[model samples]
Target chain A: MSFINVLSREINCKIVYYGPGLCGKTTNLQYIYNKTNPDAKGKMISLATETERTLFFDFLPLALGEIRGFKTRFHLYTVPGQVFYDASRKLILKGVDGVVFVADSQIARTEANLESLENLRTNLAEQGYSLDKLPYVIQYNKRDMPSVAPVEELRELLNPNKVPDFEGVASTGVGVFETLKAVAKLVLTEVKRQAG
Target chain B: MATEPKRVFGSLEELMTNPQMVMYEEEFNQIQAIVVRLVKEANARVVFVIDKNGQEIAKAGETDQLDTTSLASLTAGNIAATGGMAKLLRENEFTTQFHEGERANIHIQIVGNRVILVVIFDSKTSLGLVRLRVKKASEELNSIFEALLRKVQDPNRETPFAEITDDDIDNLFND
Candidate 1:
């Protein structure tokens, strides 16, 4: 859910980075946190287990400058992609405004990506939301890996709806901003259409 | 805007366009003041008035060492997990939670069934004193948010983003 504070003249939207475990969801957040100008970002928090796998989620609050008189703030979150963390994933999607599915591109992880997308659909459905209708995008991540699936194959499996999608190596920041920008645009556009 | 639980959206367009939370400047300042006073009275290190959706509406106290953005998100998750537990146990909601650390502790309270108030303190204050102060603060905070919800639902209220254009949003990413 987007929080539009007329008093502060700010728009706060929640965007979740979701995918299977170790699909670089956290990495996408870390890269954005590292690259964002200090003034434009808040503290990036990661609730991870001892081994560095995200136990619950990672959060990064970003200021995307102002459009007109209202400042736009996007709260970026990443769910624990491990399958057992289904409950945690559901909690994170409570008021989500947009979603960026960061799919692991390695050939071996295709099934995991598909399962995670299906999980996203079910969880959103439980919340009275449909992934088909939400402001959504896909990032074919880990594109730098040698065994990465062909973009065509990844799209055939993940981009059935043909939503705005990108290929990225989140660790190095490639296509990270593009992916974020695409979803952010869609969200703002949705807000505009709704606010009218 | 009146918190009508059964209100129909009419169509997906209505559902997709409606914002979940709205705050006016005057009310935000009022809530901010309450948070500031709560911090002083409770002798807490930091106090956060966050929407249950994990948005930090207002904050007070020394937050330099604190990652309040993360704190707000985690607190909401913690509360939601507890709420889920409450459902499983056939209870309405837990409403309050506290986690005691060796040196610092956290006290969380749900207010108005919409927002969560979290107080982080250490030896600087006792739990009893914090609880007493929060009880009063929560009541005040609850009323403020109630009014906020009503105002947000007002159909006549002006929306600042109504004038935003695609070109304007694109400009933000230009840099």
Candidate 2:
């Protein structure tokens, strides 16, 4: 859900990054946090375990400039992608304005990607949100890896709706901003539509 | 406008996502004043009023050392987790939570079930004093938000975003 505050002249939206275990969901957030200007970004918080694996979620508040005098602020969060973390994943999706599914591009993890996608759909449905209706995008992460699955294969399996998919190497910042920009644009467009 | 009887509360998500829950500048100032006063009365280092979706609506007191953005997000998450637990236990909702650290303590409570109020303090004051002050502040805030919601729900009120165009939204990301 997006909070359009007329008093503060600010629009706050929540966007969650979700995928299977170790699919670079957190990397996407860390890359954005590292690249964003200090003034444009707030402290990045990660609720993780001793091994630095995200236990619950990772949150980063970003100011993506303004629209028609209203500051556009996006709260970027990443759900713990491990299979056992389904409960936590459902919690993070509550009131989400947009979603970016970060799929691991490695050929070996294809099944994990598909399972996680199904999980995402089920979890979203539980909250009365349909993936087909929400502002959603897919990111084929770890694209730089030598054994990564071909883009066509990944899309064939994951991008059934063809909702603005991107090829990304999150660790190196490749295609990171493009993915963020794509999702943010869609979310803002949704906001406009809702207002009308 | 006719004033409807106010219910006990609704989910934070429902209140926040409602297009009618508009906050005007005048009402915001009133809320800020309440928070500022609460900070003084509680003798706390900081007080933050945040939407349940993790957006900071207003804050006061010493926040330079704090990462309020992250704090707000974490606080909401904590509240949500607790609320979930409450549901599983067949309770209405756990509207209040307190976490005490060695040096600082955090007091969190749901106001009007729409926003979370967080008070961060240290040894300067005891938890009892903070609780007493917060009780009074929550009541005032509840009424303020109640009026604001009624104003927002007024059918004749103007919507600032009503004039926004698709191009206007597209232009926002041109950078």
Candidate 3:
């Protein structure tokens, strides 16, 4: 869900980067936070353990271009990728206007990718949001890594819904903005439809 | 200076016309007082109230620099979504949610009839004090909101949105 504030002429939406452990979910947000103009972004918050594994979640708020005089702000978040963090993942998906399901493309992590997608469905349903109905996209991250699953195979396995999927090397910033823009576009389109 | 009344009217007129809305004035005053004290006593930077739909009802303290309405709306959505999950999974109500950052932290609690109160602060305040202060404020707010909801539903309710025709809504689309 998005909150459109008529008083301040701004719209705020939440977008979550979800994937299995070590699938580059946090890296995706970190890269964007680093690349975005300082004025357009807020402080990036990461709740992680001493080993650098995500403890709870990561958050970054970015201001996209204004529309109809309202500042379009997207609160980007990443859920802990570990399977044990199911509760935390569910919490992060709450009120998600759009989702960027970052699937690990490594051949060895294929099962993890499938499990994470299923997990996404279970979590989204628990939040009363249907994965099929909501504005959602998929990202094949860590494509640059060796032993990666083929993009075609990954798509066939994960994105049966075929929602605008991208191949990204999040650490190097490849396809990062594309992923963000695709989700942002879908979200804004939802707003237009709602208002109309 | 002259903007105060207009600003209030602009934000407050949504549900203000009902004959049963008599408590609105008192409730608004009370909420304002509680928020002011929370900010001062808790050493908070910002405090605000967001309706179930995420609209900003009233806000005080360090709100001018940021977009309260958007924050309120998004935060409300977050609470509502999580609240919905709690209901679906047969869990108890989610009382509060907090997000701690390097420089700032937000403390949010669900109040009467699905409304949310959010306080944003930094290292200046302790979470224990903020939580206690918010708990007290939430109880007081719950009653006021309950009364306000009754007023909203009191058969004698008048809706300004009702006066807005389909054409008006369509015109919003055009612009």
**lDDT by residue (tens digit), candidate 2, B49-129:** 988878788899998977898889998898888877887899978998999999989999999878899999999999999
Residue-level error in angstroms, candidate 3, position B161: 15
Q: Model 1 over residues B48-83: C-alpha lDDT tens digits?
A: 898887888999898887788878887888898888
Give lDDT tens digits, candidate 2, residues A1-196: 6777787788889999999999998999999999989999988889999999999999999999977788889999999989998878888988788999999999999999999999999998777677888889999999888899999999999998889999999999988899999899898877766554
**Model 2 residue pairs with clashes:** A1-A95
What would the DockQ be for model 2? 0.36
For candidate 1, the share of real interface contacts preserved is 0.67
Point out the worst 10-residue segment of candidate 2 chain A by lDDT: A187-196
Tell me the deviation in Å of residue A122 in model 1. 0.2
The most accurate candidate by TM-score is: 2
Model 3 chain A lDDT-worst window of ten: A187-196
DockQ metric, candidate 3: 0.08
Cα-based lDDT at residue B151, candidate 3: 58
DockQ-best of 1 and 2: 1
**TM-score, one value per model:** 0.89, 0.91, 0.68
CA shift of A100, model 1, Å: 0.5
Model 1 spans > 4 angstroms off: B1-19
Q: Candidate 3 lDDT, tens digit per residue, A1-196?
A: 5655444556677788989999998999999989989999877777799999998777788888665466778888888999997877886775577899998888999999999999998887765567777678998999898798789999999988789999999999988988888888777666554433
Give candidate 3 misplaced runs (Cα > 4 Å): B1-46, B50-59, B62-91, B94-109, B118-175
Q: Which docking category, incorrect, acceptable, medium or high, applies to candidate 2?
A: acceptable
